[model samples]
Target: MTDKRDFAHIETWVFDLDNTLYPHHVNLWQQVDARIGDFVATYLKVTPDEAFKIQKDYYRRYGTTMRGMMTEHGVRADDYLKYVHAIDHSPLEPNPAMGAAIERLPGRKLILTNGSCEHASNVLARLGIADHFEAVFDIIAAELEPKPSPQTYRRFLDLHNVDPTKAAMFEDLARNLVVPHDLGMTTVLVVPDGVKDVVREDWELEGRDAGHVDHVTDDLTGFLQGLLAKG
Candidate 1:
């Protein structure tokens, strides 16, 4: 199976978890957000109202709430992850179809996420797709550098021994996809509804259209199926 289309050039496929792999409307993010709020309130001795506001502020400033907490609030990363993910994992359910799709995809697959490896592992296990990826690059894996930063993409390429030109990045966030596109990797955006707004970032190479991402789709299984069919 060989075709000259853009996505066919990718020898390595990097996936952003969370909203990318699964449907975002599932409301899982709200649970995680609430956990962060609870953690902040308990550990920082702040009211729940103040804690949620500060946590959102941290996310806006540092990309990840843990980053701000570690830098300014002096919170430890492991401690924060432990506290935040202590919430109910029942919201996550196995997706055998996604797992099968992952197993069938050609080339190497890796997960690059801003979340902790513990969280990535738990989520993957819950999704039943943990065995498909060769490696999991989480928040700690990139030295705390998160998405939308070219540094994280560079670090991911280096750490995974991947060539940027031969890789494809699948992300739900358009802003995070910018650096990958700038680095010469083909970008795929997964918008489950086909109605979500794209996120704009500050570091994207100006004049290059973010809409020119190689492909956009509603789900990982459909995306992978389309990619395989193109081969």
Candidate 2:
């Protein structure tokens, strides 16, 4: 691990919502994934298999499936977001330990996600850590733009009045950290534990060099705890 003191100047903590905050094994995103596939299948009159391919293709091309759908097919963003996020959040167990770790961190905490604010709110509430964050910057807030897009990052920083040099961003996808790293923020990649055999999409895989990532950790709570200890 890089010395935690390296992050000593981070006065703002920006976190991605889905797999970064919750373990991937919890499969919370599976519900949203299936819903996206179903939406694509229904809208395009294609089989689920074909829709799955299209979903991923759009995700790769547009940073998000919804953005691709809107750009190509004129899909309504609000309805699509509501439909895809309408899933049971019961898989996310309340995490007091994680909450405590987050609380111990010094800084303004913000959730930066490509998902809807309502979805972020639901997930935070399910985790029992709703009150920990100062604000959530969601897809709508980004004007339908998504991460890995420099424009989205720029807007987020402007909306929150955050200085990238004084921020640390944690995300499950390494690609999403590229802009943050370029902006001078400390970037941490959060991967699932014991993921040797787990299948992931191309975008989910970390690059060989992973030069954009300053740190890697499987346990976000533990990582935060260590940061506090070192601080």
Candidate 3:
């Protein structure tokens, strides 16, 4: 763990809502991931395998698969978001420890996600930590833009009136932390802890040593609690 003193200046704790907040071991996002592929396959009338290729391609090229489709094929963003996020969230049990850890933070909390607003809401509600965050900045809020893009991060910072120098961002994807780091926010990469039992992409596991990440943790709740302890 990085010294908690490193986080003493942080006044805004920004978090990504997916695998970052909740442990990815639960595989809640795998359902959404599958749904994305399902949406792509059906919408494009292609095989599932082909959809898989396209989904990864679009995600790598355009920040999000839906955004790629929107840019190239004029796909309806609303339809795509709704369809892909239509998953049962009952598997997400509440983590009171995490709630307590978050509640003990020194300042405001916000969620910045590439996912939809409703999806972020559902996940937080299911985790029983919805009330901790001040607001959620979703894809639509970014005007259908996704993270790793400097523009989208700027929009979120402006919308929330956040000072990047005093903020800290936590995300599961290493690539998503780049712009935040560049903009002077302390960047944290939340990893999967070598739990290969869950569905995940190899590329998703890349880039911890690329220097954009200031801290990395496989156990978010524990990490947060440790921060408090050290602080």
Candidate 4:
């Protein structure tokens, strides 16, 4: 995490979507995962326990289970995306507060996510903030490389013409933000109270209590407002 005082120094802002876009209390991810689990159970013919483990392992090995299935098992990316994000969007209503926060942010805003473009777009549209970001770089943009991969971060910088010193990253996943921190970009970990409940153990290795992160907060609206005020 970079110093809050350095907020004025950044000229670009990058954000991770999903839980970071709205409060984790929304329980949006759980719904998405249920779809993934269902797909695994049916396709792999595995028990729920085995499906979960296999999903985790695939994510660990290929940065994303979709990528793992694509490379190892020849699963089609479009087919995988269609299957996983086919959930009902009715539960994910529009978030005016989140949209307002996005409007308040400084510099260019970009959505960086491990999910595919289709998934990202559907979520953003459901949240009613599809127009907030200047660009949406999804898993497909990264060539299927997911978060926590230094190469994906590098590609992000190159593709977007983002200067590390002039940018800050807001991510719910601490490990995913580590590379950005190492590369001299400000890192903000958005751990909204019980938001850490669903985070995996290995991903939560450093835990949210570590003071090394530039900033930790439960409220993204407050954080964005504070940055604007500081500037």
Top-TM-score candidate index: 3
Q: In angstroms, how far off is 27's CA in candidate 4?
A: 1.5
Query: What is candidate 4's CA lDDT for residue 84?
Result: 88
Error of 1 at 32 (Å): 1.4
Model 4, global lDDT: 0.79
TM-score of 1: 0.86
What are the per-model C-alpha RMSD values against the true structure?
Answer: 4.8, 2.1, 2.1, 2.6
State every prediction's TM-score relative to the real structure. 0.86, 0.95, 0.96, 0.88
lDDT of 2 by residue, 1-231 (tens): 443326888899999999989987887888998999999999999999999989999999999999999999999999899999999999799999999988878989999999999999999999999899999999999999899899999999999999999999999999899899889999898987875344467658665247788888888999999988888
Which residue runs does candidate 3 get wrong by more than 4 Å?
1-5
- lDDT of candidate 1 over 87-125, digit per residue (tens): 666677898987887788778999999988888888888
Q: Residues 131-153, candidate 3: write the lDDT tens digits.
A: 99999999999998898889999
lDDT, candidates in the order shown:
0.78, 0.90, 0.90, 0.79
Better-scoring candidate (TM-score), 1 or 3:
3
lDDT leaderboard ranking: 3, 2, 4, 1
